[model samples]
Target: MSSTLSRVRAAYARVEAVGRPEIWIDLRPREETEAEARAIDERVAAGERLPLAGRLFAAKGNIDVRGLPTTAGCPAYAYEPAADAPVVARLRAAGALVLGTTNLDQFATGLVGTRSPYGAVRNAIDPSRISGGSSSGSAVAVALGIVDFALGTDTAGSGRIPAAFNGIVGLKPTRGLVPTAGVVPACASIDCVTVFARTLAEAEQALSHAAAGPEHALPPLPRRRPGPWRVAVPPIGQLGELDEGWVAAYEAAVARLTAAGASVRTLDLTPFTEAAAMLYEGAFVAERYTAVGPFVDKLISSGGEGLDPTVAGIITRARDIPAHRLFADQERLADLRARALAELSDADALLLPTAPGHPTLAEVAADPLGANARLGRFTNSTNLFDLAAVAVPAGEVNGLPFGVMLIGPAFTDERLAAIARSLEPRVRLAVLGAHLTGQPLNSQLLAQGAVLDGTTTTAPAYRFHALRTDPPKPGLVHVGGGGAAIETEVWTLPAEGLGRLLASLPRPMTLGTVELADGTTAAGFLCEPDALTDAEDITRYGGWRAFLAGAEDSAPSGVRGTARSAPTHPHAPLGDHPTDE
Candidate 1:
């Protein structure tokens, strides 16, 4: 209970600190939100196992929240919703409280976040840059840590672009998969509700809850085909005019994926890009006019009081797309979709840059339409072809954030998510003792799904000792000058697994950063000064494995005492030590 309240209080504090009021269209009263968090705490105290217990989240303004006006980023379009949108309701039922409604592009029309009459949602990382939109507010809120996650609507990369620009995870489920019953649609048939979170796990967690309840629009969850991972990427020539930084970041991501055991394949991405272009350029855009044209018409009739000129121009003009053009475009889309999906047929997913570039606010101001269209170059095709995607932060391109998307067939959300998880940042742990490969404690790492990274020796700045404990262990302590280069093994695993291991590790030891002889540093085990009082200094042996070999040769066969103990972390992988065995 206290945890929930503390988090809520901290969230409110963050909101106040962010200094960006345009990120929200309506921020709920702090006290009211706290009260709700407290109530959730009480429910948990009663032995409930709510998945989203005590979680605080935000909803995009286009998503209806009871008592909050749905502005869709234009104040004149605002109206109080009588009830929560199904997605919001589902999250609330799972014990999450909606912190507020966030800002977006007007009528969810623009991809540059500047279309809102309220104000543009600035990039959380660099205020000078534009935050990708129309899911602007939701992405910024999550990026700033003001909320655990936020709900957004995506038709043409609104969900992904902001997330990429903000350096967060954006998970957009298959089109119409999560019910859109209460959302103010930009293109009703193609609009998808999405989740923005700091990590893939958290984003997926929110999605698990949001995808439940009444009026879901999809087939049952898909059973992924069993095989080695084969991910498709665009051919080098197809990359066009990307900057060196973007190209490098993307190649680095592929390298990381390869290291994580995925085979990479190249596929021509023209069909996908063409279909993406059609979402806004073809007669398909007429769907947006059908959604809010009448309201725009009424507003224009009333002296054009509150329309954003760019958004108005897009939607109003969409109304005049000839009827035959609409059918022709549909036929065109069908052929394109077939070609695109066919290329993806033999692969697990198609990986691509989340956006062509991250534009600064000034750059966007100079060419709003062109900049936004460019942002959608890698994104706009998903909904047009009923695909599922998960956008992940790959690395930085120069100083700005760069992201990549893993797109797969519709209903393959979970599969794409699993592949994306492999590409997420990982932790490399160095161990000088017990947890090494072939040791009794090595099973801990294996159990946690950790894989052996490699072996390396520490920098000559540590003293190694064999501790006197039930499970004889070796400890390495940084000694600055008199230390020797100690050998260690490195293992890599998910950050979550490392956390679980850290929590279960026993005392007198720690998982601290260790400098390797190769000039790299990694999380490694170290012991406290006091714990080494009566321990044997084995630095001369260079490593625990060497010491163990010497002891076996010198001691009698029966002298080896068996006193095995648990590994440092519950879920960990480690290296050799001076064990009696």
Candidate 2:
């Protein structure tokens, strides 16, 4: 959408109306913004289908944009990048113009939006409240609608927490899905280029375009399949203390999900919380030292001001971590990662408040480290565990915004995107046999943008047979009275994804309406009666997994089976049943 030079002028007018220069460390002149907008219009006229054409976005100071010094919210460390970060280049190419580089916590440390020397990024709705950082300015820019969306980095909840505080959508893609080629590394190993948008679709589109570029150390993302979305919530006891208003809002949020045909399950918060602690309390702090230690040392030795005291202290202490301690922490992290995957194996995603609560600027100043650590309670484990997360606004609490985050194992980015979409269009599908989590064919479902909603069973009206296929498959046939309830998982996908999934299905397997244990019916897998003629009746095992476990027991230890007992990664130490971890 463009209006010659008029629309760009209007956008700048809105920028001035908000009048929060402190929110941005380096905002381009109105003339420059207009020029860029006009340029985008010219490109559109040239028939470019730039998904982000005519849109304005802000980049976190940590991310490079040519012509502007990347301050990373630290003036002492500012430097002009030779070119835009790959992610930014992709967005700009897609027709989105940059408004300016926004502020952040110095060196991308601290979750409090207040750590920046440019000035503490005030909350958009209430200036006295914290904006949530280190993506503070980027989130506020979108929160105030100053920009259509913004690019933020998520090392330890910098992206999602800010979105929660500002009441917007923050999509933190699978760790390496979005290129971080030009981002200032907070923790290079886990730093991710994240997107903040007024809507989930906007963020998803930006993600799609940005992730298409070449990347370094790209990791595999799980292909998701469709079914009922099962969301896991931490028990009240694990949520820790929050204001009465926030607690009420959280409960209401869960109730809303439950009422929306979603099955909400309780999860043990121990593993997640423990892993989160590792981000700062464990050897992971060494990562921060590795990223900025040289600069910090130079600053100190040269008599220049160093990082915000708290951040400086954290990195400084990292030097004391012995080599063996780093190895020990890695081992600890491996165990935690496995346990986390096991915890999430049964459900489509984990749902939690984006942050424990919103702290006031005054509160953060008084206890920066403590307050900031609380903000990352739900987000710190995401990157460490290599998962995808999206933060969605839920409602307000005591006049400040509250939000919930949906987190899933890696490669669930698209599925999480669909789930986070407002009024999302989707179709529910029940999946039995190989498409289940950790199964060999599960990728087929994921490739079609399917998400595992949750585990369930067919209403004692279906019989399962082990077919004699080369790779092994299950055949489910509806039986009148002698059938048994068979374990199955429900997955959900975009309506369009269903066709792709069906097209990929081989013969003997077809889509059919199946009754679930919950009295609901969904399009699911079914087999032609004739296909079961020579198949073995495995219905007595109740589910494909049970049969696999039985087969494994009869076979020698360490012998592999059709179903994966655990993820292939060495970090995952799960058993045959992922949920059993």
Candidates' RMSD to native: 8.2, 15.8
lDDT for each residue of candidate 2 in 1-581, tens digit (9 for 90 to 100): 35435546656787889988888888888888787778877876797656566567889999999999988777899898999998899888777778889988888998988886788899988998999999999999988867767999999999899998888889998877888889999999999999997666457656777787555324555554666678888889898887668888888888877766777888888999998988898888898888888888788787757467777777788878888988999999999889888888888888888888887899999998899888888889999998889998887887887898889987788767655642234688877777677775664455334556776778888888898776688888898699878877777765645765565566777888999887999988887777888899988888888788875223221212333122221111011111100
Can you tell me which runs of candidate 1 are displaced by over 4 Å? 213-226, 428-581
| Most accurate candidate by TM-score | 1
What is residue 152's positional error in candidate 2, in angstroms? 0.3
Give the 10-residue window scoring lowest on summed lDDT in candidate 2.
572-581
Q: Candidate 2: deviation at residue 426, Å? A: 14
Q: What C-alpha lDDT values do all the predictions have?
A: 0.82, 0.78
Q: Model 1's lDDT to the true fold?
A: 0.82
Query: In angstroms, how far off is 170's CA in candidate 2?
Result: 0.5
